[model samples]
Target: MAKLPTARIDKLLSSMGYGSRREMAALAKAGGIKLDGQALADVSDRIALNPDLPQRMRVAGKALDPLQGLVLMLNKPLGMTCSHKEEGALVYEVLPERWRRRDPMISTIGRLDKQTSGLLLMTDDGALLHRVISPKMHVTKSYLATLDRDLRGDEGAMFASGEMMLEGETKPLEPAVLEVISERQARLTVTEGRYHQVRRMFAAVGNHVTALHRESMGRLHLPEGLDPGQTKLLDADEIALIFA
Candidate 1:
């Protein structure tokens, strides 16, 4: 048997994007890790990936990858949770089985609520995740909201001035653009990403959001004809736009 330098399984899994280092260790302890034909005995065990050995290596019965990262965007459909639980509907449920079979697990950078649907970015790249979600970056997210009522005159001014109160609190939002699509619809652009912010901001301005859809995050727009629940790989330019 050709012996390869061994490292802790948890560390290997973390570097492979399986999960964070801490989470991967916990999974290994739970008998969720195996190597060769035997259950993993030590989280720190150095295992040889000898090609000569049958069942050379596996994690949760899945082969491990030593290179490459996965990234993609999904036009998430409403009603799917963002969690990874085996039961109940989740965004992963909509992904093909082949994707789920990959060694490194993909994770969403930021999540959309089950009731709200639009573009969502998922990747195994930890640095990219931090760059997009960190508040200091101030990445703008544009959304189109269909409201139950129309906004005119003072209502339109209120949205632009950032004077809306969210959840009865008096904190002003960043400058936003509100354009009337119709008497009952509007397009809103915001730089701050608060939880349920679009809905709350509209509600604070006395308009109830009936349906909300995110059109873009930063400069990356949902590609034309990407139906709900569809996803496509983002190219270098598309990814760069999000940070730019």
Candidate 2:
């Protein structure tokens, strides 16, 4: 396991919704917080410098255990919705309770729709989510789409130039990269993620996307051996790929 870095005790706890740092400090002042079986004297006191060394912390008669902020790449299966609504099977239900409990806000990096599947990343880190999903960063997402018919005409050129008009959007979409993978399939690369974008792009060209499977986001690709509905924690190097 990788070592968890050190930070202020109250700040860490507050990030986990324990309370604000000042509030936690006041609680410490009231003798409600304990460290190693003694009343904590300083809110600034830091423990957990090493993930190997377990630190005992308690508040309001309950232990305060911090998660290491796990990032998981899930191979989303069909019939799942990433959101919490009951419109379909909740995607986070596929995660173990341990990961789902990181916070109520753990979310998929980008949505894969109810029927589209593959390469969904889930995490509790708000900073990581914003950095990866922000449109200004130009991070590329790649997908393999099965279409209703063979691609024809200057679809590739059209996608490359951002010449196609999507409905109800004021600005033309940023250019997409489309390639013919087979008679009924093609690979697409795009930076911006409008609603049902790959399907819409194909529809604009008079073809229909019958199936869509995202292959990669930035440098992170779904490993072939990973099966649908399975998840694996992303290592440090793999997490770095989100910003690449």
Candidate 3:
């Protein structure tokens, strides 16, 4: 039997959603791509896709596609790290014993600092992760924050006026929705996710965030009645909202 014709290196990498044509070409030039039984010689080089090829393809010695992709949301409890650090409690630790046993190798779409909690998503779909995290997508994330003090009248205007500075940056934040929920709590909705942003923003205006909880991402709200450390699989529409 005749072997199938080879696919161009750039085409294969692009189909895998590694990058755009130009970017994939650069990666190929940097020796970042491989084909069955040989390193890709050029971005335009044609390489056959062997149906019998082993699942463990190498790119910079990193394993590819060892586990199926999974998308789920967890109500992350404080004190769990988002990373897979060996020394500390990672977010996966809070999953039911069955999920850990499956060893699906999921990762968070974005991180919630160890001190903040709620509406965290874990998945292995790199394409969707990239889309949602990319600034171009402009996905909105909402949070309910409990502060140490109340904002007096007209203080909420600062959110729209860009008076808040998140940590590790000198520039003010993009416009956001800030509404008082109570004397010591408020709802904040923003399109950008910066490090400790909620806390820093409150601090910039003479208030302190005592507790923070994310309520939604895009159109998907945290599952009703979900308690801390619990998780559930996301439905199709909910998944669509992440990219919407």
Candidate 4:
């Protein structure tokens, strides 16, 4: 059997956002780039991006064992927008250069406004993103809302009924869940990704939403102690949990 052709590590990873050639060279000089658990002495060396060949490439501490897929959950902070062309800082900026643009191109699974904060999902798998966030799938997104006053008038029943006529919608919602935690705090869960749905839902019932924080999407909850502006790659199980 013949060996596969190799790709320049710097070319492949730099295109994936590892860094500039000089920056990668610096990392190589500092002994940060590795191949198959061995420190690579040269950043420009060509190697097969083959996961099956037992030659993994690592930058900093992240191992790009398989160069085809990536999924990350970020604890998005307040005031930073989510977009490829937004005017301000982007959530994806927290990730390493390699995680930014590659063959498949990374993108957010869904989106959170600059004000909302919590578990934000990013991935290079287009099908997975669609499977999880598509309205037809009915995946539930949970939110912790701080309101101006107590929920009144059978709000829970109304949410469960899905008959509230929100503005610009031709019909009612697909039913939602609302649980009061206190006079001013509540947990709301909904399946649709309607623009400002949670805030508007409370407003429809005559309450004002003051603070909105997403808590979960599907079975994937933002892990405890994962602070704002921090991010971590999803473990295999954690990735599965998003669809579980």
Candidate of highest TM-score: 4
lDDT of 3 by residue, 74-133 (tens): 999988888877567789887654345343346788899887889999876777787888
Q: After superposing candidate 2 on the true structure, give the runs of residues whose Cα lies further than 4 Å from its correct spot.
A: 1-46, 49-68
lDDT of 4 by residue, 67-171 (tens): 555688889998878898888889878876656656677888888988888889988889888998888788889999999988785999999996888977888
Estimate the TM-score of every prediction.
0.68, 0.76, 0.67, 0.80
**Candidate 1 C-alpha lDDT tens digits along 107-157:** 787888888888898887788888899878878888889988877546667
Q: Note the residue pairs that clash in candidate 2.
A: none
Ranking by TM-score: 4, 2, 1, 3
lDDT of 1 at 115: 80
User: After best superposition, candidate 2 residue 38: deviation in angstroms?
Assistant: 16
lDDT scores in order: 0.75, 0.82, 0.74, 0.82
Instruction: Name the lDDT value of residue 92 in candidate 4.
Output: 76
lDDT, candidate 2, 1-244, per-residue tens = 7775787878766766666789889998988888678888698988665543234767866766545565889999988999966666889899755445444457888788999999999988778888888999888999999999888867889888966778777788889888787888889999988899889888988999899999999888999899999988887899888668
Sort every candidate by lDDT, greatest first. Answer: 4, 2, 1, 3
